[model samples]
Structures are given as C-alpha cells and as structure tokens.
Target: MTVRFELYSTWGCHLCEQAEQMLQQAGLSGQYQVLDIVDHAHLFEQYRVLIPVLACRHTKATLGWPFDQAQLTAWLQLQLQED
Candidate 1:
C-alpha cells in the first residue's frame, strides 16, 4: 500500500522549494499533497513558522525543516515501521 503525506508550504519560499526537491530525490514524489498554508488560517497558524514541514496524514507525524537526505530517509523508515 502507498503511504499518504502532506507538505505544508507557502509561495515564494526557497526552503520549501529545496525541500520539495529533496522529496523528489528521495523518490517520494506523487505520494503527497502540497498544501499552501496561506490559503488556510488553521494551517497557517499551525505551520507558519515551519513552512517546509513533511507530515504523514494518517499518523499526524511531522518532519520540520533543516533535514538532510539521511534524516529524511530515517524518518520515512520509522514511519513505515510504525505501520
């Protein structure tokens, strides 16, 4: 089964772009939705300061910014193991 995820981000953010690139490089593309926090007040409040957050929809688990490829991989592994 495919895992679901969401990426909380806003426009004009270089970090968000970089995070997206990392997601693609990590072979996680097309399995997630990209949500622009600016369009939703609640999401904005929740992730305003953490624009590049990657979250598991089912578990509500989050990975914030400043993550490298290894960390991203490890996080994904942990999420998979949890299932």
Candidate 2:
C-alpha cells in the first residue's frame, strides 16, 4: 500500500520516538511510513539535525518537530485539502 505520509527519523532519538507515539496517538499508524535518514544519503543530509520531520507525500508539505496532536491533525487536514 502507498503511504500518505513519511516520517523522517533515526534510531536512538528520543524525540523521534515521541513523534512516532504522537503519530500513533493521532491514529495515523497505517497512513504513514517511518524512514531512517541514515539509510538514505540525501535524507540524512537534509534531516540529520531535523529528525522526526513529518512529510506529506501527496502535497510535499512538511511539519517539523515540537508538534502536538492538534497541530498534526491540522496539518493533515491542510495537506488533504491541498491534495
């Protein structure tokens, strides 16, 4: 299945873990995929310091860290509307 969102992250990152939990709590567990930046050279370069970035595949929109569930939901709504 094609995922609507991509979560850029890496291992051993507390914030990244929290972001995953947030996604789960927001009921987006299946609509997204977690991508390890370490496994992709360009992603590593772009998100090394910006781990836990949430990107919408459909609209190419991104939401960085420090986001709560409400913010995430709002972003998703915006992206869906854009699509």
* Leading candidate by TM-score: 2
Local distance difference test values of all predictions, in order: 0.87, 0.91
How do the residues 1-83 of candidate 2 rate in per-residue lDDT, one tens digit apiece? 45899999998999999999998888887889999999999999998998789999989989998898899889988998987
Let me know the TM-score candidate 2 reaches against the reference structure.
Answer: 0.92
Evaluated at residue 25, the lDDT of candidate 1 is 90
Top candidate (lDDT): 2
lDDT of 1 by residue, 1-83 (tens): 36488889999999999888888898887877788999999999988998899998777799999898899889988876775
Question: What TM-score fits each model?
Answer: 0.91, 0.92
Q: In model 2, which runs have C-alpha deviations exceeding 4 angstroms?
A: none
lDDT of 2 at 71: 94
What are the C-alpha RMSDs, in order, of all predicted structures? 1.5, 1.1
